[model samples]
Target chain A: MSENNNYTFVIKPKRTLWEIDLKEIWRYRDLLFLLVKRDFISVYKQTILGPVWFFIQPLLITITFTIIFGQVAKISTGGAPEILFYLTGITFWNYFSSCLTSTSNTFVSNASVFGKVYFPRLIVPLSVIISNLMKLGIQLLLLLMVWVYYIINSDAVHPQIELLLMPFYLLVFALMGLGFGLIFSALTTKYRDLTFLIAFGVQLLMYASAVIFPASVVPADKQWILFLNPLVSLMEAIKYSFLGQGIFSWFYLAYSTIFTAIILVIGVLVFNKVEKGFIDTV
Target chain B: MGNIVIKAENISKQYRLGTIGTKTLANDFKRWLYTMQGKEDPFLKIGDTNDRSQKGSSEYVWALKDINFDIEQGEVIGIIGKNGAGKSTLLKILSRVTAPTTGQITVNGRMASLLEVGTGFHPELSGRENVFLNGAIMGMTKTEIRKKFDEIVDFSGVERYIDTPVKRYSSGMYVRLAFAVAAHLEPEILIVDEVLAVGDAEFQKKCLGKMKDVSGQGRTVLFVSHNMGAIQSLCSRSIYLKHGTIQQTGETDKIINYYLSHELKTEDELNLKVNKDIPACVTQVRLLNGEDQKTKAYLSGETLRFAFNIDCQAQGNYQLGIGIASALDVNIFSEVSELMELNNGTFEIDYQNIQVKLAPGNYALTFNLLYNGKSIQYCEKVINFEVLEINRMGETYSLSKGAGFLITQGKFTIN
Candidate 1:
């Protein structure tokens, strides 16, 4: 008899519609954490400034948006100061975009590791979300410091009771990004056409999400177009909650939540189906 | 037999041929539509056999077809075959890295696979960091890796540069570290695939020794290798795979003999062509027994001779070389005929009975033609032959790693 505990593992073709075994994921949680740590550590290992890129990237992008949209284009912030307005948008936008791009590349980028070893395939994308969550936390603090500075120095910005809703907004953001990322990645594994389309499509998606201009400036009839996007309502609500400006409604938030939940469910189902066979096609 | 630790029931894998199989969405939709109607997958019904040469008539092929076997606890089994024989595919399915098209496998214990050494070693990570990373990727926990960290470092013999980035290490050093980490994974079942072929001869011998020690410790091992000597020496039983199906499986000597004799008998040598970049090609290779009779196999007591028929585009000073490689693809010995000896181009340059000291198991002959101090034509594993098992120097075992790669005349005493 062997010294270790006896365990039997069965491997067969995945026949079920739902192949996402939560128990397997739990068993591989340590690998998931290591993958997340690797992604976080290796990102800046060779750079002279290291993780300072995390701060500099969003800061410079926010400055460009401020100059291009607020100063030149005459877009309104709806009473919130321009710096805090764009800064808040950049924080959430950066997180959502990074999540989407990384998730979409899950099978393609990790095919080497995935092809060689046996771990829960979900560990990869979950790590993407977890590692990005750490980056988001640091970026969130940076945004808060700017928000506090504006509040202490000027009357152009103010915090409202709705600011308490920020955590819910973050959850919704994570779910939507994670869900859609899973969907795009699963599809593109079989057909490479989506890879290029996603790279271009994700950029265009930002324009529609109102990352630069305030949602209140839109014409009433066109507001429906923005609402149809699952991320738009959540982004506007996140800003309105903190800035006390723009329209904020629990109904729209709830609608976005339902939309994200449905997408996430579809994402999981598609991801499960494709992962088992995607190795061959890819 | 003891308890069955691994059982594969009716395992098979079907692959579609050509780019159209993977690149088209239309066919996938068609297949999906057929499946939704509760019918057999329409594409799976038709295909050619898994042959790489010549164009086939169908687009779908079964890579591994209905393979069934059971391994008892603590049994070390070897799987061997030529290229495209489904050996790697079978190992992949058993390791759970991929799923079979239709089959089930039950494994009764923790299993770890070393499909390739250093599979997840990041170039930027130091050797120490990669040890933890690669171990974790292979399903080892932090505590488990920590417990064996120093042993792994010691085994690799790279402790002096454990903190240096692995990218900076020489290839031999990298292989040392990678193999060291993988070897230390103390799973109940170990699956290895041709990984021991990486390091030098001494290291390979060391790895084989380590693997034998592991099996002795009561862990079941499934090994896939082309090295018949290693297989004959290490495995208690063996499986011979041909074109994605089990051709034979039984005692180690029986299966290895069957595989070698099978390969030597059926391999059509007219198709083997040397490098086209050169003006010469090796037309045929043959081995004659001591009685001057052509043979594909011989007993260890018989004299071995290599006779080659070569062709040249233009008659000139051509030096012909013959290289002998173990079944594992290691070039152990090579000899070349002098240009002065091959003046008559078409009827010359053959080596005969220099010394036949090779131990038992399969070996292959590779040829190189040097037109003037430069190798213009070369071919690897062009013609292979087996040295069947026979008593060596009064010893019962003739084929074994410890028995050595070649046989030498020695005095034996029986008092």
Candidate 2:
């Protein structure tokens, strides 16, 4: 007979998939912030430029893409400057890719800490998202400086009203990254074969996401296939609002929103099921 | 006394006993299929007990099986067991690091576990930042760590290195700082597992003192340790586990006695081959009778004899110490012989005609060979023997096992 009536929490064999325990995650909010700080500082601790790498990384990638895709390949940027066109795509794509790659290693990388202590396991991935957001902010400032240069110098550049959707774009990117990362992380713990795929899968996904070229370049008949990628519209939308190029359709953005929502829900359910016993498998 | 702060009902954990890979994926699919058809998990019905030495036929083993116990608030309970006996498994379940397979544990208040000293200390971070980071990882708030920052630094005695990166600190300093942060945590229930095994002796003493203060404040403590002395002194009650089940749960000393006698192999004679590589070593130890014949069992109140043969590679002054300890490794009596100058050779030192008033139970003999004042070679439980029932006048009576190690006859004249 159980006599204690004032128990705080009871641990069970299996919890409902939807019981995400938002309140428990809220209680560990301080830990979440601390871990975010750790991730930002530790990565650039010994490097000479430190956080400046955030800016230099996207700038370098933008220049390289412009040289390769704009000069050699002769891909049209839809009248936007080659540098600006590629930088816009690289900045947003970098954040999403980094979030996906880092968060996918959650269970494997944190197996040591996770084994010894119990906290909201979601904090690891959540911290990654927040920390990468800070990096994205820095990279956006770089984008802003370049955008101002092209705006003042050239009459062909047009800034659209849809530029106000920056926050919404960032939210969708974060959710997509977190969702895919959680699902992959859960499976990676039990089956390590997924780890090999994740390294190159993000690379292969970038071409389909319209990062280096405008989505309009795709032939009209095959455009649907490129639009099927959830990130394609979001990528094209960011470029369209900034450079006044690429297709921006309400129907495509809605598809992305709905797809991201589905992925995130399944992500949380699978993540909740795995976090309880991931230590054993990992 | 405090309405049972923690209660476990039918706690059991089953683990598959092979590499987890594609093989387990097939099993997972099978289990899923069974669940969809509204049938019980078939693998749950067949699992052997977790006995590491004996190879079992089944692929699944129960790491902990039907473990049910209620821990009251402020009670310091020690869990003692041999390696792979499910001690860590139980601690993991209690700390919520892992889930049990078929049981639920209910706790009334906040719980913190120090399964390790430094769970998440970053080498790149300074001591000051790590204190905050490690504190946060252990479930402490930023405000809480700030309030206790100065005290934690002082306790660790590494104030000068507070801003220096921890990677540069010595290993001892790291452990000291790690334990210092953990000691300041005030939770309703604290689960510690062999963390005190780290740090220097003085630091270990400080950790023990801090733990005493925690339990003194009416917060429960569940401690798992291999150090029997610490367990005996800190906890009044203990649980002894063997092969995935609780073998006994009672007083700490009695449980320790049972563990030592049953877990350790019992022998009356120890024969060791002399290795010429070592300068000096204990060769052999034996328990003898009045006729100088080797024996293991003795009646209470009889004279005990011991022989220790030692090999000395070089000539030096050697002192031998002979000790008698109870089954719990508690020293009942000991004698250190006068120092004697000896040549390089093999010699036997005999402790003969020693009066034995030990109670009826298992016991051990310890040998210490010292060069000058420092011990060159030491062996514990070199020879284990038993003290049979006491014989008084014409009758023989078995003394209660828990009645102390010494046996005495007293005059009873009631007025």
Candidate 3:
């Protein structure tokens, strides 16, 4: 027996501070796909229009912003068509907000399952983000149609080669949403007050991110404050990349990326530690 | 054994009793501050286990305290306890659904737990989709589940409804499919907790057979159940818990004996008061025992003796009798007097209890009072007793093995 123990010593079973076996997660990928598909179908399962609600939401929001801000207040769209400009901001912001809200509530919504099983908890939040991304893709297609219509009819619209960087902007927004969502998810497991705060906080964050107005409207003195909001850099970067009209500095985008990375690291650390003991408290 | 699959040392879980809210937070913080200054947590020293059941004592109960045990591969261990006895709490801790307040549990293999069947199954998802989802939740990989998909559907007997959403399936079908998926996953360690109680008798028997098969595959199992029969039949070793403490841990029969004898205490007498008068009263009751002071659990097809004392008031030739009943109040047999018996006085009766060849189960003895051979008072469930099967002679002599609690002497030949 001693010899057998010594022979098995080569396995070196030692507990690490943070040991997340990603391969085990990969093995359950089929379940992850099924969950995402279930989320997509269940959202519109009993609805009259089915997937049409996805397009209607963004279109209605764009029209509301056009009448309230564009026609009445003359909120500048920074030389881009009002419909294209508003739809772009609303479509991307909706994806981020939905992903953030859903991911933040993952633990509370799945506590029944979590209390009874021992699966990797990361799969739930990851599937939520993926499902929201599909919704974002459909909304982006509608925005692109508006962009093409303006390009053909209006000479003031100048589509720039920088528009090819749209995917990079999407990645940044997704990372920001996931990072903040994970932090809230971990905290909400203990103090459920965070759930109520997040519902209102997501709406308040849109005002600070320049989603309703052009980034150029922020005065030179107040531009530093806009830079403090990570989503502001993300929104302005996407606007400048596509419409060629807002501030597009690599320094600001780099700062946003670094901020997102740091928060993502901290979010993972907190989430890992919280998952170990949250069932007892939750 | 070369394979020591699980090793737990001094694992104790201490939960703060009472409402877990801001007040507990304040106390926890105060305790933390004192600990930093070299003082113990003051509240931990102020309570004992006996004070736990009283109202307004903060309901501060320890669910499990100072639990330590280990198991080798292929060993099946039963956790037996009453409600609020920490059986589920210990399983939850071992299954990683919750963490202990102190100590460590070292496990050498992947563990899967069916703490409750259909835990992660989405109600809107079809049975086919739920198979994968619930399997994943129980720590089975897609490839592993895919390989067993057909077998799971066949075993559940829900093949026709596989494409239908589980919310629409009958509850029996839902549980069967859920248990099927959990059983087929085949992890190194299986933890089951009271889920078998939900299924039908046939399904429960099927589940027990599957559990036996899983253990036969050289894996470890941790089973928690309140059913002493199931525990004794399935587990070689068993642990008995009482008030969050380990009362006994050893061979299954020994632990079960301790549980059945020590833990099954019932109230001796009933105290009821009407507005104007005391309608009836219990004169005397005592548990009969052998010379060893141990309650006689069984008799060898002969009469057993019980000693009783009774006092009567305002009696008009009262008839006295004793009835033997099962725990659930189904009377097995009774002896009553048809002649004049008693008056306003005290008396004692000693008789060898007659045998009706009772089965091995929990039973109760009730005494009845009658006036002029007509029943006047009935004492319900007066004293609780247990009948155990004699095990030393032969396997066929076991009362529980379809012997119908009677010894017969008829010979039969095979066709």
Candidate 4:
């Protein structure tokens, strides 16, 4: 490699939809892995509960949802145990929300680091997504415990073959969240007001995505509107595959997957272009 | 000579000069419109001159302009300039933290930049963790970092607190750890920008030694610093920048001489005028040779006479002085009229300039008119003269040492 080396590395005019040189990213994989590890360890290092906060967060949300929607409002869990149903929703929802929120603040949060070194800007957000996957894995284990208990005690529920599709759905959710997060992160580098608005927007999006309530109960008149929300379809598919009691349309699920892939492509394009000069504007 | 590892061709960076958000949006929109029209950016033409420190009509200034340079493999180059002289801007461009507004840069190998100390260090992460994080940010592989992790920890001397969060460590420790990580990482091309100024004297010495080692290993290094002593000692070649352009580039000694003689003088004089008042009621003055006792240029390490004839209305117990200041406006040496007790009977006071140990450069003189305890009048730039480099018989005395103000010889021993 050293002998045949040409001195110059040309940056050709980038006319493609996205100009990601995956080769460069692959070369920095160690840095990416280290950064991800740092993110995971540093989050709870100083806290009293440490990694327990990961479980505590979903546990607390499940309790609150059980009180407000399950008991008082008489919201149905589609014949699945309320604890199991809500924990499943909370598990997936938390991962998506964490990925989106963390990745959205990628540029602002890493500005100090970015200002000082010459690393690919993509590494920071990519690390955010990777680290949040660890959090998602922990929450999934908690949901699995609830799921196993409900299956043993109750006669109305049994795990379905659709449960095998859970990983596919999670992958879609990760890609969608990462795509939107990168877009928002790139935009927030210049217009910081978007960062302030994202928290409230994600909260509002939760109610729309059937995290606490089943998508089948959203009313037949508004069913198409619910179907239009890609996350709604993802959530419904995850629930139906595991609990066998919620709506699952292969057509809608496929549409959601395709939508996420498209969004990811567009996100990478915008992010690559914006990152080149974002330091100056930021 | 190896291939050129880095090539920068006519690169330029433009920055808006006021409050942040307002102009960026307008300029971004204008750039978008121009892109739609398939033409160059319109605001690029309307930018003011490339001087950041000066007040100008337009809010946008080019931080760098038409900067073109090439770096060969195994070359250690120093970049010297005053603050706001676009030195950092050039480094930022080379590091790819930001893109240039015009032109392109080509590089063959992976480049690592230590532009600021503790750049990627997370306050919440322990020193051990931050080392890996910072190393990664500088583009080191995991195996590479693991291989040198112990060496880095020992070099930083923060081993006791390696597992403790960096936020709990002192700032000096943090910088030491950060610099250790940066220096130990085996990048093909290393870019360091003034990060060595963070630590104490011993650490600074260690950093300089490490820099020399890096250069000796046949790696290309681009160092930016205001410390001429370090620059002179480490770099084989140097580029002197002024007003966003390359003023001179070549051997470190020659470029340093040119920078000190021409560019350093004007900035020094301007800065000196800012802090101190010129001596009072004194006309033009100059330094002269002792035999002639007339205004004449002197050489480094030569004894000469500083002659000043002040025109006065009524002669009192007035004090006259002459001082030589550095480019940063630090007074290196000064002599007062009271020391020689030259009274006002229309007399000439010629102080025998001793040691004349200043480096080859230009120096300014200020003549003062003082009555009793107050300064009645003062005139700066009373005279300006150059210190030419003298070549003795078969030997040359280089004046690059003695960094601070005056050149002195001293020895140190570590027990």
Q: At residue A84, give the lDDT of candidate 4.
A: 79
Between the candidate structures 1 and 4, which one is better when assessed by lDDT?
A: 1
lDDT of 4 by residue, B1-415 (tens): 5688888888877887766775668777888999899998777775566665567887778887787888898999999987878899898888877788787888877677778766677889899888887777777777888899999999889999999999999988888888888778776788888766657788888888888888888899999998776787889999988878888889997887677766543321111122223232444344566456554355566775665555444535667666775443346777666723334334555567676577755566665556675766566554556655556574443354434444455588899
Estimate the TM-score for candidate 3: 0.81
Badly placed stretches (over 4 Å) of model 4 are A1-17, B22-27, B266-415
Docking category of candidate 1: medium
* Model 2, C-alpha of A98: deviation from truth (Å): 0.9
TM-score of model 4 relative to the true fold? 0.82
lDDT per residue as tens, model 1, B1-415: 6888888999989887777444477887898999999999887786466766657787778889889999999999999988899998898888777789998988889899888878788888889889988898888888898999999999999999999989899999999999898889998899988766667889888788889999999999999998877887889999999988899999987887677667654232324454455656566666777777777666765666766676666556778888888765567788888773343344533477546677776778788878867887677777777766655565443244444577777899999
Candidate 2 per-residue lDDT, tens place, A201-275, comes to 999999889998888888999999999999999999999899888899889999999999999999889999998
Evaluated with DockQ, which candidate comes out highest?
2
lDDT of 4 by residue, A156-248 (tens): 666778888878998998999999998998899889889879999999999889888898887889898988989988898888877887888
For model 4, the interface Cα RMSD in angstroms equals: 3.1
Docking class of 2: medium
Q: Return the TM-score for candidate 1, rounded to 2 decimals.
A: 0.87
Q: Each predicted complex: what DockQ?
A: 0.59, 0.62, 0.32, 0.41
CAPRI-style quality class for the chain A–B interface of candidate 3: acceptable
Model 3, runs deviating above 4 Å: A1-19, B24-61, B266-353, B357-383, B387-415
TM-scores for every predicted model: 0.87, 0.92, 0.81, 0.82
lDDT string, candidate 2, B87-158, tens digits: 999999998899999989988888999999878999998899899999999999999999999999998999
